[model samples]
Target chain A: MTAKTTKFVQGNEACVEGALYAGLDFFAGYPITPSTEIMELLARRLPANGGKFIQMEDEIASMCAVIGASLTGRKVLTATSGPGFSLKQEALGFAVMAEIPCVIVNVQRGGPSTGNPTHVAQGDVNQARWGTHGDHAIVALTASNHQDVFAMTVEAFNIAETYRTPVILLLDEVVGHMRERLTVPEAGAIPLVERLRTSVRKGVDYHPYLPRDDGRLPMSDFGGVHRYNVTGLFHDMWGFPSDNPGVVHGLIRHLMDKIENNAHRLAHYKTYHLQDAETVLISYGSAARSALHVTENLRARGERIGLMELQTLWPFPAEQVARECGHAKQVVVVEMNTGHMCQMVRAALGPPARVFLANRMDGVLITPTDIKAHLRLIAGRGV
Target chain B: MSVQDYIRERFFPHIWCPGCGHGTVLNNLVRAVETLGLDKNEIVMVSGIGCSSRIAGYLDFHTLHTLHGRALAFATGVKLSRPELNVIVPMGDGDALAIGGNHFIHAARRNINITAIVMNNRIYGMTGGQFSPLSGEATTATTAPFGTIDPDFDTVALATAAGASYVARTTTYHVQEIRKRIAEAIVHPGFAVVEVMSQCPTYFGRKNKQGDAVEMLRRYKEGTVPLDKQPADPEKIPRGVFVQRERPEYCKRYEHLVQAAMTDGAALT
Candidate 1:
């Protein structure tokens, strides 16, 4: 049977399709607002695809289960919203420390503690980077529309598998609930990245955390002939817990360098009409939709305004932001949160650009009208 | 191969106290695996954080030392991913009953084919003799120097009520019984819990005024009553299997459901 190439799908539903296409065979999650549909869809479809889906008792267990399933050489996923994401922080850290490959989708709602359950919010932008304690790096992606949601979900999985780290797909209620037409790629068209398993014989020369030339150690399945130890503690090259300062320093450096040194390759963004633009708007997730609309309207009116929509958030795409915003006289960061990503934008641009923010956090999205008004104000002030 | 063959020699001279009952429990666990003739590679040992949880690191098998109180959840992942592997979790009282109580009950409810060996030492030995959920009422602990008013849990009863297909209780002092029950649990087709009442001499013993590990073992022997015997004192904890019955295992049922779904082609939904 041939697969449908085009279909009207909600952002959350597209996430499920993306996961399946990316080779996700195991899903463990609990029901949470906005994100529940992703889990529900997977629960219905995973079994049909001969995969496994389980509704764990809570988000913590869900995260732990995802990590465990990943250890068995299966691509695993879990979805949750704000409060549930809070509960998953520790387990997420565990995945980082152990270098397990998995994907986590956070359909973000307003929260400081279940502040608003059914509304859109970008409050988790910082949490996605610093939610888990300790010194670590993470890859987070935001989806602006249904098609991007589907495509980014696959990219999230690939990034996770390539880095052996948990990649967070941060979606807000706007895109999560909105339905749009998406062109599903045919099978074999979407590139899939699988975890690199060691070629060494099982018991001959297997070291769990020993790094190859490229700085990543190949993974081994739990039930495979390559029996090795997996732990949450800082460990030596053999995956055994160690307290030696030198070993620990090297471990931390390697973990950081893997993502930092390759940030250029991992960074992803789209620039619309950025050439010779005098003003640029920086946005991500659902808020980027408004920025795009405003940029198009303003450009038609002969305004030198462009938009730089960020698909990858964490590791911040600093160099790309700096290069894209270099020629612009002013930059405005638009978001549903008060000023989360705006800080990073300002940090990337630094002094002299007069960085401004157009934000809303009252469970309402930042509209194109708001961005237009902000631009008008800047134009009138002539500052 | 002998039990000693299962020991990860690189981690020898374990960090457990000289007379701590954890050694005895580990010995029984290794013997149980040996008796079943299960290949070491086919067995995955998991543990949460605690004195008992450390056992996973010293065993010669695919092992995961997970977050505190999260071993059962991790083990569930392993068992579901590869149903053929024998997944075993060794957790402390706090690790099993306190922080991980939700996972414990839910795992039993699902009746997943993972053996949870809860080493109930009554006190949080790793955290320096603090009160645990399994510590009896009025028991003096570091956290409760004046005496604890909290009630204790009957682990066997709790496991049985939580829908565990197999439940048994034994003390570390009963080496042969521990080995027998552990072997039985490993072979059980569904969720099985064997709660081993281990002794913590360093903290539990000194804090409670019980003599060292030897005296604690003697006291445990005196306190436990065989399941078939009825003691006049209703407070005495019962020993032996409290529940063992047949039910479809979680992973097996999941596999069957997958097969049905594949054959019916979305009609099952």
Candidate 2:
């Protein structure tokens, strides 16, 4: 009972703890089921902690508000689900264009358009990458348990501040609603990344979009002496809107390269018993839990199978995935979506025939049995 | 500092057309801020996408040129997060009343301390001539070749009904009043709306056969009656502060809530 570090909480609640731990100074969100608990808890906790929390009139407003708050040099975020995520796509794009650091948590329920509210699906894997119009790069993280959820939530903020770009925390229903024990990490144990502020004095001109030698752009608070522009248009170093072809081209490439060039560093995942394996199962989010369970069960029976649980979905870790699963004779991706992550795995491995999918879309969580069935079929051993 | 000191002189020549009233608004806004003696570092001008929205680009304060019809929403976040900052939002007619209408009413209802300037030029100038929410029943535009059927929103009435503590209306013709009203709106402690009947000579005027900027201003002088000189005719647009009363500001109220939470809620380690 030494300070009781472990506490039982839902995935949504764990996320709140992680955000507060990450020094979230402002949060603006709209209520959407499967994600409402995040805002609800923050509404009470944020004010008490001297952080600002607002329930905006709608999803778009919530996203816009967070972006504005972020410009003022405050760490900001917003939480939503499928339909709400769609509403936020425009503002999300604005965040990308402006290079404002903020976090957006999409506790994805079923979708194409409001497919299910109480069920789980990894359907937003592609949406998180391509939902916002135009070509832009995004960092999306996911986890299968409360501890990982807590950790990834903190990482989302760190990554956002580091890149001066918005990070998406995509959680599915199963992990979001499931209650589990999470031991909160002691402060300073996981080093926090504060946004690098401009060192130039008040009289000197501060370039808001100018990158340093290490590729990180420093920022100035809205109330600071360096009063400059922040716009959604392709801008010069001064942050003013520009239509010049050179400026426009440089910006698009820069935005894409900032995250893509660093994909190796941005990738996050866990490998289990994959030193030497004949069959590999690639998965992430809530579905990875079942995949890990099946991997352990089949290993006990002396079958050479392993699990690779991916945390980074966007700037999809293509190189690491290809390198990790390259030795496997058969790779099966287990998830609750229609082969979304499976397609990425196949693309990484370069042959669809060797890769298989174990998926459930009937609002049921994929279990060990379901994954085992896919492995049996993929191994050419008919049950 | 002079009005020029508050502006980014590099980007001008400016973007507005020769007779576009948004320039007048930008000119007067600089004067208003200068008159109030507000520090430029303390000011944050946020604007939505439109002809008027470009006002943030010309002035030198911390500016956020945001998405269409979402200026107030962005300003709400900026003001509420940093209560010490002065947040001003200048939106176009369609930008505030059409796609951004919900945000407009809610921001007013919250009585947040942000000055909202609605430059009502009945047609959409940025996207060429299109009938706006402010284009009354008979106005013709590129979109409404046969004349519009949409009724215009009464900016004063809407702001007043939506709980804005300071609601005022003026025309681009009244250059002095623009400075007076905007300065007053900035000084007001609660939500304030100044609906400037700004003329869009390039689009709204040409489409409506209202001559040029000069003719439009001539019409504004004849059309609007002052509050002190109350006219019986309902057709005359009234120009002056219509609603200026005290209500707790949103950011101030939030501060009180934060204080209460800190004093009474379970303490965090």
Candidate 3:
């Protein structure tokens, strides 16, 4: 392994550093709470690193700019919170439909609409998956700490480039503000993924959306000789708008299959003490930290409990959740929202596992004490 | 290459209705690009949702047909990411002024090197006949059957005040003038606005007693005054170059900053 240097950094700061290491050179964002630091840091560092940063007028424009930059063969990034993320949904859909590669960091705060600006919440879990309209696929990852934030930012870019789709790096206010020691990996140590550009001669034989044998289309830069169209409308392989049912159906299915077929490769999680546990705690993001602490304490007291911390939230990772929590007598889903992922866990675990929710949505972290209380209740039921 | 070579013929017969002035505007735009001898591969035509925005599909350039009023934001990204390409945006009156008003002003304020062509037809033609920000007061539209109380926007004035380096206005009736203005806007080296007063005979003309396409074209010829022949009445639409001044373009300034940062050894962190 290459030598690395450890430095004290906030989660948000580590996100920017990680993006730079991932070869990000274009950033377009509008400042919002719990996520503004990512944009501010990028503004200062991007120019120095031979990258570009633009503060757009609003979240919509910021998202649009990110998509535009990505089309020109640059790794682009943007960060926002609850309300800003909502404003970015339309353009986010644009990126999804156009198959642009970019990363969006949503340092989530409490919200139905501006519920709490400086507090932690994973309320955007569902929004990140289904925020945009229509039938489309997405990849989202949640980071629980400063180091995880750095590592996941790099992974977010790689996943986006590999799939040619937008990846949401979901963080909560607590992880964003909390500072910790994070190791800066040596240059070229962390694996990087670059977009596949068209190798077909420019004017000779090129169609923008023509898929390769692997089912992913190679993108061309806007100014490159291989000029072609990009549109939000349902398009044929030539990238021009088409209302033909066969073309429309093929386009949508290809987009979905590209991610769904590769779900096994993208699904990621961490398990603790699952070897002989009878109860499993299913949690993610900041809430996972609490669950892990609770699991360790309960195990010390000789309770057969384990923790399954999910890092990749979307493509739901149902198979992994089922395999890990299938045999448990009880499965408790700990989250900062009112049963967003809990519903998915239930669907994944099915009837026999007896899924239960341990949630807190009042802009406060779900503490170990609360999770322990839930575990005690489950144990008392004596399944 | 011939003008026919620049057209995406497979996507045509064009969508514009008979007598629609947007066809003329499109024709002028094509001629303008042709006059400058720009390679089709090096140009990007971006458009928002409107009848005019459909031109992006019919052009063989690198085009983006984006959301209603968000074309400028998307084009800004394309231009900044690859400054070597010439980016042009075509927007309707409602698309540019009603929904995309903020982006319009900000893009001009930045003075980025992109040419914006506003097809000011004075009404929302694509969505039927709704009153737009540029619809003349007292004009009857579907949403304003009793005559509109809302004031119309002077697109040229707004763009000029917003810091665009080049601003000009011409009617679709003045085909040669529109083509000349579009070419000038493209070569301006900074943010440029060319407001083409296009006629929506299907909506605005039918609603206002402006007769058919021919009558509306005749009215355009008779109603508008040249900038030198200014009438005392402020309502008269004057046609000419309203603003042209030199300033460093946004992308150039960004490049200079990048160069300085690289040479000074100033780390971003």
Go through the candidates in order and give each one's C-alpha lDDT.
0.90, 0.91, 0.90
Clashing residue pairs found in predicted model 2: none
Q: For candidate 3 chain B, which ten residues in a row score worst on lDDT?
A: B260-269
Tell me, what's the RMSD of every candidate?
Answer: 1.5, 1.5, 1.8
Q: After superposition, how far is residue B243 of candidate 1 from its true place, in Å?
A: 0.8
Say which prediction, candidate 2 or candidate 3, comes out ahead on TM-score.
2
lDDT of 2 by residue, B1-269 (tens): 88889889887777888888988898899999888899999999999998898899889999999999999999999999898999999999999999999999999999999999999998889999999888999899998999998888888899999999999999999999999999999999999999999999999899889999999999999999897776675678889999999999998889999898888667533
> Candidate 3 lDDT, tens digit per residue, A1-383?
14587889888998988998899989999989999999888877888888888999899999998888888889999999999999999999998899999999999999989789999999999999999999999999988877888889999999999999999999999999889899989989888988898888845768888788887778888878876778899998778888999999999998899998999989878899998888899999999999999999989999899999999999899999989987888899999998999999999877766999998888889999888777668668522
Error of 2 at A355 (Å): 1.2
Q: How far is candidate 1 from the true structure (C-alpha RMSD, Å)?
A: 1.5
lDDT of 1: 0.90
Badly placed stretches (over 4 Å) of model 1 are: A1-4, A381-383, B231-235, B266-269
DockQ values per model? 0.73, 0.73, 0.77
Can you tell me which runs of candidate 3 are displaced by over 4 Å? Answer: A1-3, A381-383, B231-235, B263-267
The docking category that best describes candidate 2 is medium
Write one digit per residue (lDDT tens) for candidate 2, span A229-320.
Answer: 99998899998878999999988989998999999999999999887988888999999999999999989999999899999998899999
Worst 10 residues of 1 chain B by lDDT: B228-237
Candidate 2: where are CA atoms >4 Å away? A1-4, B267-269
Error of 3 at A296 (Å): 1.6
